[model samples]
Target: MRSATESQKDSAVLAELIRTLESWKETVVIAPDTPDADALASMFSLAKAFGDGDGRSAKVSLPENSLSQRLAFLHEWANLPVATAEDFARADGFVVVDTAKKSRCNLREDVPEDWDRGRTILNIDHHASNTRFGTVNWVVGEASSSAELVYRLLQAWGWPIDPLYASLLYAGIHTDTSGFSLPNTSKSAVAAAAELVERGADVVELGERLCRSQRLSEFKLLRTIYANTQLAADGRIAYSTADYQEIADAGCSAADVDDQVSVPRSLHGTRLAMLFTEGVRGKTRINFRGDSGVPALPLAKAFGGGGHDAAAGAIIAGPVPEVVAQVLPEAESYLNRLAQKP
Candidate 1:
């Protein structure tokens, strides 16, 4: 539980955020690259609420072919334009959801040249490692997810969250908490989810679509991830690796790897789990998951990455093997250090 002091601080920050949005005319909400349901859902609620005859004129940045197959419904549902160059050019502010740093969000070439410093930036996230890279930042790592935060924000702003927005919020919380199986799941998260279901969020359909829906190529990649699994330090460390060829052969794109890292992290005795994927033989992406006794962020930071205690990731410039050699020992040592902690 967060201390009273921390809760009060968060409340104050939220008040300021509401004040800022009250006067904003036009804005762009950006979800990071390879956005999961949480980021996209939060963006959906904020964007649609401000759209229509509403003078706010909030638009979202949708990257081409960046969304995974499961989340493609969002694009068509929103009926977003192919290019919002004119809207972006005229936007008075920018907002980013579920992203820790500027580098993490998709800053495509089509974005306005002054995107970074051109106007007000609102950074909202639930990661402990957030850099506060916004004109106003509300980085509450203890929050269940940014969707939860957005829910509260809409309520405070007196905006009506109908069934459509409720479903989006439910999707965000459901995915980020790993269906309430993850360590980050809290009592408040459960309460919020229950409330959303009461608000007509179709729990069964969202679960069926987000969890059970997987394309053929995604299934093939899962097979490769399982086959590549390796054990180290007497099973204290479980890791897997896949290069570009394996991914291509599986007919899966990089964005298709939604939760493949969860495969290694599911081992019974693993204190630390890692998944390494090489992107086009150029940069390798590493994902980390730590058991309760371990914290994943420190291990991620040791190699210049940042994320939550239970999950984190980094993209290092090296081939798969090279990156693996550098990360494995660090994972092993991190677990060892935690084991020795009194």
Candidate 2:
């Protein structure tokens, strides 16, 4: 639940978003690099809120030819089109959902650096580190996911929640909250989820798609993950590494790896878990998941990344071994310092 002050703030921002929607005739929705299920659902749900008898045109820009195999259904179901220069030039406004910064957006190459200028940009996100780049920013860092923010906004605007959008929102919330295992899965988040389910969301189908099933490629990656897993910092830290070749040999992309850090994190005494993936040459991506009293965001920020305290990531310019060597010590030092604190 929001504190009194936070509720007022939410009211103000939500009012701003509603005003933007009422004025916008054509809205374009976009997400960040390698958009996840939460990002996709947030963008699509917000898009659906645009056109119901309002005569407004709202479209989601995938900008990618394909989704991860797990999300393959979105190719047909999302009905998103690849973004083009004309789309941006013609859009009355744009909505960037679930992204923390402009640099991370998966916009077309022709999109301007100061694109938000002279435009009604709605920066709807649930990341505390969001730059507030939107003329109308509705960031709820305490919310489980951007999908939750969309639910609240649409509910406030009296936009009916279609069954398909409800299913997407529910799936988005579940994944972003790590199946409600994370600390950010608050009572309100759960309540929002319940409402989505009650509103005709297909929980059983979404569960099968998102959780109960994995692709053959993902199973291959899982074996590789298990083989590379390691423990450090007196078992307070657990980590795994997967290089480009290993992932390629597994017939999987980075998105196919299902938060494998959770494997190490499941250790009885682990305070921090990391998955170092070398998806691109000379660049290593790190996923950080932390237990209570151990903040993951600080470590991510130290490496020029950002997300929630319980879950965050950074893409560093280094090989897998070098990054692991560099990051593990910093993690250990941080844990050691925490141990010393009163």
Lowest summed lDDT over 10 consecutive residues: which window, candidate 2? 74-83
| Residue pairs in collision within model 1 | none
**Relative to the unseen true structure, what is the C-alpha lDDT of residue 93 in candidate 1, on a scale of 0 to 100?**
78
Predicted candidate 2 versus true structure: per-residue lDDT over 168-194, tens digit per residue: 888889999989888988998899999
> Candidate 1, overall lDDT?
0.83
Q: Give the TM-score of candidate 1.
A: 0.95
The Cα local distance difference test for each model comes to 0.83, 0.84
Q: Which stretches of candidate 2 lie above 4 Å from their native place?
A: 110-114
Q: How would you encode candidate 1's per-residue C-alpha lDDT over 1-342 as one tens digit per residue?
A: 879998888788888887877777877788887888888888878777656425667778877767888788766666655327777778777788999888888655677666655578889999999999898998989888899988987877778777778889989999899999898789888898988988888888888888888888888889999999999999989999889889889887777766788998898998889999974567888989888868899888888889899889888998899999988887777778888889
Indicate which candidate wins on lDDT: 2
Error of 1 at 170 (Å): 0.6
Cα shift from native, residue 278, model 2 (Å): 1.5
